[model samples]
Target: MGTLRDAMGYPVLRAGIILLVLALLISIAGLYRVDKSYSSSGTLGEGMHYLGDDKFENEYLYHNRTLTLSSTNATISLLQGSEMYNYTLVNDSVTLHPEMRPAIYVFNGEVNYTYDARAIDYPYAVYSIGAFVIMLAGIALSFIGYTQFLKDVKGGKK
Candidate 1:
């Protein structure tokens, strides 16, 4: 630990660098999100049924001929955590917009009975927070070893 070169090779410094790399990997994993797709038959909005929860970013609607979201002019209470998105319907296929926008869809009581949707379920990542903590710890530890080496090189051991 007599020079910066020696400090870079110090065991603590090496461990800190390893932790930094691990943190980077964890952060990357955090960005990787998996979308869930599913189809449901029967009543989409009748009696009581939920679409998705806050745990989901947003649910994209894909309507087939066997599906109509709600009865014609049915009241959709936005206060219930359910929102609308802009979408385009071609033939029997529905494509949701990538960005969220206030677009009301009225099915006019079409005789479609099945609803399929793709939802991005992850709104938060525990791995990202963990990676941030690891990064901070690694920087702190690396600097600790760096200063120790610098002090030894200056012959100011106290």
Candidate 2:
């Protein structure tokens, strides 16, 4: 134990510990509680069609819906682990924010989803605690190595 402590008695070790702790804190804050939601909207687009029994071929009545396809002013923050970009719905009641807010994806077969953010199903307490523990371990290891190096240098270990 004494020899181990000596190896970790360096300023570098202290800096390493601080860095590890900061990393852990940031990760926990960012990922510990992720909000999830789901939402969708239907729109009519004009395009070519098939002509059979007097059907409208290569034309659609929804042409005037062109103005409906305008983009909304919504920015999304995509997390590292998450596959979709989570965004907030703006004031517009009929616009889809780019972010994939985690709401119920399916209730019936309506094909329309709600736009809301929700906490993940799992509890974050456990993960937060584990991250903290790992950070502490990293700090301890750094400290030990630093002390050891200091001792070796002072005693001419070469």
Candidate 3:
């Protein structure tokens, strides 16, 4: 590498080296910490109030009653670790009708959750391989720039 560098001036090679370092740093950061999230289904109903430990609640207004049910299921989320990840919990299935046996059964409302995963599913080995490729490309670009600068100097063409 120094042999090629002797043909290329110190200053231009230094600049290329600086740019190469920056690119490599950026590529490494991109592969460092990836994350994800997920959501699931549950049952909600009308009555005393809390459901599924403490996740859901019941509210009454003007003698009318309603329930909010929540369920937990394994999910793949992306915004679990950072402030940039924002998600909304919208109920996909809200209403459950009364059952035929009125004495023993009642309405069963279903609530759904929308959340992010704590980590991405992709293997670390794959991400490392990709980062390695990016680093090589960055170094190659720096060397190419260094050679082009030397070529300009030799031709006396600026």
The C-alpha lDDT values of all candidates are 0.52, 0.41, 0.37
TM-scores across all candidates? 0.54, 0.29, 0.31
The digit string of per-residue lDDT tens for model 3 on 3-55 reads 55564455645665765676566666655543332232343232222212111
Score candidate 1 by lDDT.
0.52
Q: Which regions in candidate 1 have their CA more than 4 angstroms from the true location?
A: 1-5, 42-110, 122-124, 156-158
For all predictions, the C-alpha RMSD in Å is 7.3, 17.0, 15.4
Q: C-alpha displacement of 46 in model 1, angstroms?
A: 9.3
* Order of quality (TM-score): 1, 3, 2
Which digits, one per residue and each the tens of the lDDT, describe model 1 over residues 8-52? 777778778888998999898777666676554543332334432
| Cα lDDT tens digits for candidate 2, 1-158 | 24645544556675667668775775666454443332234521222211121222112122111111122333233232255433333433233332221222221122222332222433345566666766776777677767667666777872
Candidate 3 ranges with C-alpha deviation above 4 Å: 34-43, 46-106, 109-149, 152-158
In model 1, state the lDDT of residue 25.
92
lDDT of 1 at 22: 88
**For model 2, what is the alpha-carbon lDDT of residue 157?**
78
Candidate 2 runs further than 4 Å off: 1-34, 37-125
Better of 2 and 3 by TM-score: 3
Tell me the lDDT of candidate 3: 0.37
**Candidate 3 TM-score over all chains jointly:** 0.31
